[model samples]
Target: MSILVRGMHGLGDNLHQRAVIRQLMARDEVFLESSWVAPYHDLVAAGLKILRKATPLRTQSKNADREASLFHRGPLPPRAQEVRITYTPDLVRARGSVLAAMCWATATDYAAADFRMAVPAEWLQQAKLLFNAWQPRKPVLVYRPLVDRTEWGGCRNRNPDHGAYAALFDAIRDDFFVVSIADLVPGQEWIVSRQIRADVELHKGELDFETLAGLFKLSAGVFASPGFAVILAQAVGTPVACVFGGYENSSSFAGGARFSPTLGIDPINPCQCFSHSHACQKSIDIPAASARLRAFFAEAARHWPGCA
Candidate 1:
């Protein structure tokens, strides 16, 4: 029987997860690598065989007293009974699809493989086909200044909070089409600035793969905040205004774009958390950000054309 398992953890990331499924599907009778987890439903439907592994649940507590009562767990079902699994709390199990994903085989793996399934040639567009097809064809632009925060590590919510960011965005919105997929979406009443009361909606998609890449190519430009999206955009030859932080770019995969990384080391645990996303929250100014954005889009216009 083919064995499917997850050696990584945290519901996994986008790239790590997709590569696993893609690699496993190529096998014959061997179908999936469920990795002995419960979240294999959606991924299995996409392909890959979800197998069952018969392994007893380990005790979460190391205390002797608690360890004694760890036997309360029961065995998995028959489909699960046919296999054995290894404990991989970190989730980095792309034995074969690693090169395609373009990261080090030694890089920590994740089950949430968003990028692997999000970009690439066919994958990116196909992933968004269902969603983008429905967006009102009103010349939508992905306005993400979050990259500035990631660049310098200076907490400049300037767009709305840091300074005049909210006003700047409002000004731009009045004359141009805009939408936001910010890292943290405050409450509708939170009012980034004066609560212009703008709304951004999400639509579900059902694209195959190749189509996904096409959409990325069509984008005017990507205003990002040092995240995987920027990397993916660059892969498709789309220009990226990376609002990033820290000179040490751990997530810098294959790409060629300007790194508008933020400032500040915040030395004593700058992010308060090591994750890259948090670093960007500190930098990024509004007026300065707006000027850069206009330039980036204008540059994109030279290639995509027909924009103000």
Candidate 2:
């Protein structure tokens, strides 16, 4: 049987689908989206076909938008069975992880799935060279700027006070070599400037996708808002100290959806506010968060030899 797995909504969603895709590749021929091809260099080399679709024009009309969506999503072979993956909170809680939830969606065995990302040998080598150049004397800690979703109904519920991150980074400065990572839009460096100053900056173009995943594998851990960075770290077997705000806890993304049980980090929201509204105005406790992150990294270092 031939399978056409539709592309997911975001980078993290696409990463979660990797295990499911691998399961399909073992049983049948599989085709994936062009946008989804970059992160899975290994899978592509292993025989995953890139789905080709006609490009659509940019337009504001509803009918034109619908047509564009169809153009990118359709023209499937009549004999090929298409699989559309969907997400729900209930399914995620039941399966214990988003990867498991997706596995269940595609009739794949959840226990047998492997979520670790495999990059090319060259990428790993390049990452090691980059790490050595830094001469990092302490355990490396990744610091990503706080960025909220900008499209498809933006959610600010998980956004904490930008100043909180600065304090956290400052507390860990002497013990950790911080590497700030973000792809800021032109004239938008304030997104990171407000977060914290780091020993090194890896903005856009500093490294490619696979190489960055390789760097994550070598790091002690990462501090990020709930998003793709957390998923990327988990995929590469790196510990992540997810800095969550009051509106939403790790249950939605970090701890619940994409939690790696072996990592041993409970990225829960520790704030006084729990309003479901997107405009939630609760402040996160940075001092407490910093303490937990320090402890989390200490534990990770005990097990992960890469921390040295």
- lDDT string for model 2 (1-308, tens) is 87888756566777777878888899888877634455666787777776633233111122223333322343555688887766565676676556667877878887777656865677778778878889987788778877543443333555655666566656666677888887644543325327466899876636656678778888877777766778888787777766565544565443323334222222333432334465544455666767776777777666666633
What lDDT score goes with residue 73 in model 2?
41
Segments in model 1 whose C-alpha atoms lie over 4 Å from true places: 1-12, 16-47, 50-102, 106-138, 144-175, 182-219, 227-239, 245-292, 305-308
lDDT, candidates in the order shown: 0.36, 0.64
Q: How do the residues 47-116 of candidate 1 rate in per-residue lDDT, one tens digit apiece?
A: 4444332232221111112223322233333453222123221221222222223233323233332333
lDDT of 1: 0.36
- Candidate 2 segments whose C-alpha is farther than 4 A from its true place: 52-78, 93-96, 187-193, 253-277, 285-287, 302-308
Q: Estimate the TM-score of every prediction.
A: 0.42, 0.77
> Worst lDDT window (10 residues) for model 1?
261-270
User: Where does the lowest 10-residue lDDT sum fall in candidate 2?
Assistant: 55-64
lDDT of 2: 0.64
